[model samples]
Target chain A: MTAKITVEPSQKRQQAKQLREQQLLILAQQILQQDGFAGLTMDRLTALSSVSKGTIYNHFCSKEDLFTALSVDSLQRQLQLFQRALQIPGHSREQVLALHLAYHRFSMTEPTLFLCLLTATTPAVVEKSSPARLALRQQLELQLAAICQQLITAAIAEGSLQLAAGQSVDALAFVQWAQAFGANALLKPTQQLGLFSQLQPQPTMLLGVNLLLDGLNWKPLSSDWDYHASWQRIMTILATEAPGADGQLN
Target chain B: MTAKITVEPSQKRQQAKQLREQQLLILAQQILQQDGFAGLTMDRLTALSSVSKGTIYNHFCSKEDLFTALSVDSLQRQLQLFQRALQIPGHSREQVLALHLAYHRFSMTEPTLFLCLLTATTPAVVEKSSPARLALRQQLELQLAAICQQLITAAIAEGSLQLAAGQSVDALAFVQWAQAFGANALLKPTQQLGLFSQLQPQPTMLLGVNLLLDGLNWKPLSSDWDYHASWQRIMTILATEAPGADGQLN
Candidate 1:
């Protein structure tokens, strides 16, 4: 009974600490959305929050640490979305496409967080971030990569996909990640340039992924199946799961 | 004779102004290389250069404008590299891979300048930049896109490739651009993460481009011919053209 009393109070303290940290993170995200990277200062965060400066500092040592923390939060959100995507009923190829779609949705709905992910990767930011936070971010990245890796492995096992003699699952997964990363990163900036204004009304991201899958000679190639229909179905199902999160789906 | 005499002095003045502008840009690049983006300031540039503050401001209205100008210069260098890559003797598909190789080389050798291109695209930088410089950047982007488009068009015209019913030349070119950009952007950062250390030995950038081309069913596909050999040949030829530019090409 004495031990329970001692452990209960410590557990309560830990829970309270986690709650405050979550509040700070949400506040930090608001500041980022409102003022961007330059506007996110430690003083601003301290001033805006009800928590004392000392407590805030305990949560994050510096602005870069806060940024890294934000990246971890964003990546956690992304991992959740990927997990949700995997639950959708389909072939492994469609599940892979769904993963791409989920990523696109994340980039669209949470652009500030998307930019945070990009910024956290830079040398300047990475150099200043706390090692614990950096390790957490790396762990999240590996988990995301492993999710894609699992889908690829399953496809190969089921005989829906075949690798060339020299190709490895990790390399192919990296290639797919690069394509998705490239497509989404370029999407908004180039669209703002009106670079796509002259092009036909086709989904460029879908086209890129389709080409990559077809290159892999994965089953149900673009020529052999209406992947466009599959894309629409996945979008509909995802929208139902997260209503109004992304209404910009074309 | 009177008109010629009157125009000579003004023409000479213009030439002198252009010379000073070039010198300022070179000095700014030096500052950027040595100290990075945050260290670049008009005060620093004025202090470092022989020119006065007023003259320096005349060349670049703001730091963002200077960044835009630097991006314009970088794009011009990329344009020249693409032109050189086109001069290599090979199929149009090989020429396309050469374009990717040239871009990889540029990103490797001039990472800071490549980053300038990315920063110049952000809304904050674009909003502050002078309209004239932004236009120049856009024009350079178009010219680069045109180079890729012509390759795709040639491949299709010669019966080496075909697009789906909905795919357009502009869309395919954009896809290829995204792949290259994403691959290059992620390469250094992820490599620093040691993400590829466990994977088998392979040239990933080459793998990405080859998969993309294979998806398009371009002639001499990876399955039918040794693209690894073509990549090596292109690298050798490009190395002869620009010796010591990229010694790290794997």
Candidate 2:
């Protein structure tokens, strides 16, 4: 007798639902980029995507729920860029810096999408989102955090980075994430405000990350090495991942 | 002979306008913290503050303009905190760290205002705010940046911070601001997400600053000295500036 592995009916149904959700999310992202959060009504989404309102509701409980899904999607895309950054041949510090560059490029490439992610985090959005959807977003954030944690662990093991007394890998990862987010999010606007006219996003970010790593007493500190050259290399690696990326950077 | 400093008609008008704006902003902040952004409206402001609609309009061209004004007020408050942080008796590095603590304390004490500042940066808000209001907001941001720049300059001049080749005082100042903003803004939500439950904002921020300072090779690196002791000392100094502050930190 011949035996074959089979998909359960429930699993197949779940897969179909996920596929439909993905289709709606792509259209939602387009709507988000074009019109922003206030414009992302279910009526507009249905009219634009041709996904029936009922079907959209089947995927997302409310507009807030849909926004949460978009946030998850945005982060998934960011996590992918970070994964690509990791593929660049380098030690863990370089890898971490690669992740920083990826974040900056991602922010620059689709600022609207980044804005959507920011909007999705607002108390207004969070208060209305379904518990399950919020849980899923949390899970996505954890996955991204795990990628960063791994880099910190690798750096420690390879002696490329060190933890100060009483410090943990988890705390170090949080610092990196915050530093990158702050630089990418705040730098653009500060410059636009004509406040930090001299502060360039990519360079300022690289400098901040280097100082942070140096503070960690990470091996071959920026003082001992040329991170500017590493930044150039990371840019080249990122360009291979996304064509025309060089044009996106200032 | 004593010369009189007389106020011109335009100057008196401007002074009166400024006082009116401050009164409205205080009421607006109450609404923002209690009812959030959606509930803050001209109708509500008129009802609660008993300020006529025309007078409110005379001060702020629109609700978005009012929010921008609120953002300017919030930054002014933050700048004041930094000024107090600077007055703390200590070395330049400690003074810098004191500013970081002030940011943390400010964020923790009034998260809603910080959220207002974040929302103020959104494109939708920026697009609608009056140009003059935007310019004022920009001016406030520059004032805050100047306070931070002073600390960086002090650190460098005192030999507490050494700039690597190709780094400028402006760039280093920008880096510190970004790093501090990143740590404080990003920490609260991550903990709420339960991703970094073990991470404490004050300590994590101190670590990140220490690393950056270390990267700058700021003297008394965490490895060389007990910065945790310095942290405690800074907290004590800050407590005198604002009583009951010691009870706020975890």
Find the candidate with the highest TM-score and give its number.
1
- What is the per-residue lDDT of model 1 for residues B132-200, given as tens digits with 9 covering 90 to 100? 888788888889998998999999999899887778899999889989988887777677676655653
Model 1, position B115: C-alpha lDDT score: 78
Assess the local accuracy of residue A149 in candidate 2 as a C-alpha lDDT between 0 and 100: 92
TM-score of predicted chain B versus true chain B for each candidate = 0.90, 0.88
Report the C-alpha displacement of residue A15, candidate 1, in angstroms.
4.3
Q: Which portions of model 1 miss their true places by more than 4 Å?
A: A1-18, A34-47, A51-58, A198-202, A244-250, B1-14, B35-44, B52-55, B122-124, B198-202, B244-250
Pick by lDDT: which candidate is best? 1
Candidate 2: stretches off by over 4 Å: A1-20, A35-43, A51-62, A244-250, B1-17, B36-42, B52-58, B244-250
Q: Local error of candidate 1 at B57, Å?
A: 3.7
What does candidate 2's lDDT look like per residue over B91-195, in tens digits? Answer: 777777888888888888878778777768776577678999899888887888888788777777877777667788888878777787777777766788888
Provide the clashing-pair count of each candidate structure. 0, 2
Best by DockQ: 2
